[model samples]
Target: MEIHFTKMNGAGNDFVVIDNRSGIYDDLTKEQIERLCDRHRGVGADGMLAIEQPVEGSSSQYRFRYYNADGGEAEMCGNGARCFARFARNLTTEFEDEISFDTIAGPLVATFPGEDVCIDMSDPFDIESDIELSLSGTPQTVHFMNTGVPHVVLPVADVTAVDIVAVGRELRFHEHFAPAGTNANIHHVIENGHIRLRTYERGVEGETLACGTGVVANALVHHQLTGAASPIAVDVQGGDTLKVEFEKDADGNYRNVKLIGPADFVFDGTISI
Candidate 1:
């Protein structure tokens, strides 16, 4: 089968987007998705986004399905959603400042303030603080939350110096988050407004250049710790920068969470299955 695909990236996280409005590959298999995102054998991306038709009265502009490199479906991806928005705009002439879509998790909204795409990432909840864990015979504290998906944030004095693969891998599958493992992140606060982060994504099973949801997770954790305000600038493993903004409710929870960053077109082509 010859499938038409568009390759895109947001800050460095890449995706293979297919306009499956025709349902040509409706019965897509986990193996197929894994092969498609295989860096050595297939299109090579962090994940794949399929633009499916919105269900009746969904109150959404469209529906997007996400698949991880491991062929697992994801609830939400901050960077991929931004790339999804840009890819959606490219497919239709009805361009609007704001675009809304439905995911497995729920409905989401995206907007273009400039060249960068900003997504209203919805509310974050299920916060667990000071989680005790044993790493290398030492006890450490980690913070956990769900911003569309589950993430565990570890505050380190030096992000780059930390062994992300080892620690992140251990924590991601830790007993605390058993059954469905969590994405792990190590972050360093540069100051009140800036932070550096590195993530070990669950589906990707390794660190990528950037992660949109992870960025929001780290920033929100910082806010809870330091009373830092919104519009926090985050520096990812990739050289590019991303911005996260949100409004806190009276209950000390975060809502109106937004992730702002660059989503750029890389290339497009036809690949056979």
Candidate 2:
């Protein structure tokens, strides 16, 4: 089969996006997806996004499906959602300034303000602070949260000095978050509401330019640790800056979380599979 696809990126975290609304690509196998995302052999990307028709009775404009570079389906992807929004807006006439879509995590709304795409993310849960874990045979304190997916944030003195892949891999598979595992991130607070971050994505199984959920995870963790205000600016490894905004509820939980960043169109092409 020949597939027409668009390439997009959010803060340098790239993806291969396709319109699967008619279900033409429904039978796409995991191997095929992996091949599509192979940097050496295919249209290199951090993950894949599919724009599908929303489920019956749902009010969303569409459904978002994400597959990691390893070809595993995930609950949600913050960057992918932004790219999906822009892709959908460019492809469909139904969308104007904003659009809503459904995912395994829940429904999400995306808006375009200037060149940036802002996503109203779902409420975060399962937060744990000051957890001690052994990393490289040394005890370390880390924070955990589920922003659509599980993430472990380690505050480091210098993000550039850490062996992200090596330490992140250990943290990703750590027994504390075993079975499902989790994404790993190391961040250094630049100031009260700004930080530099690097992430080891779970399904990608390596360091990428950036990880959307990982950015939000780090931002919220920073707030919990330092009482930083909303609208945190995060400098990602991709050389791009993304913003995360959230409000603390009466219960001290995070709500109205938003991930804002650029979703750019790289190119469009057709390839036979």
Best by TM-score: 2
RMSD in order of candidates: 0.9, 0.7
**Whole-model lDDT per candidate:** 0.91, 0.94
lDDT score for candidate 2 against the true structure: 0.94
* Candidate 1 Cα errors over 4 Å, as ranges: none
| lDDT tens readout by residue for model 1, 1-273 | 787899999989999999998899898899888999999999999999999888788978789899999999999999999999988987777867788899877899999988899999968888999999998788999999998889999999998798899999999999989999999999999999789999999999999889999999999999988989788999999888899999987987788999999999999998887
TM-score of each model, in listed order: 0.98, 0.99
Clashing pairs in 2: none
Which ranges in model 2 have alpha carbons more than 4 Å from their true place? none
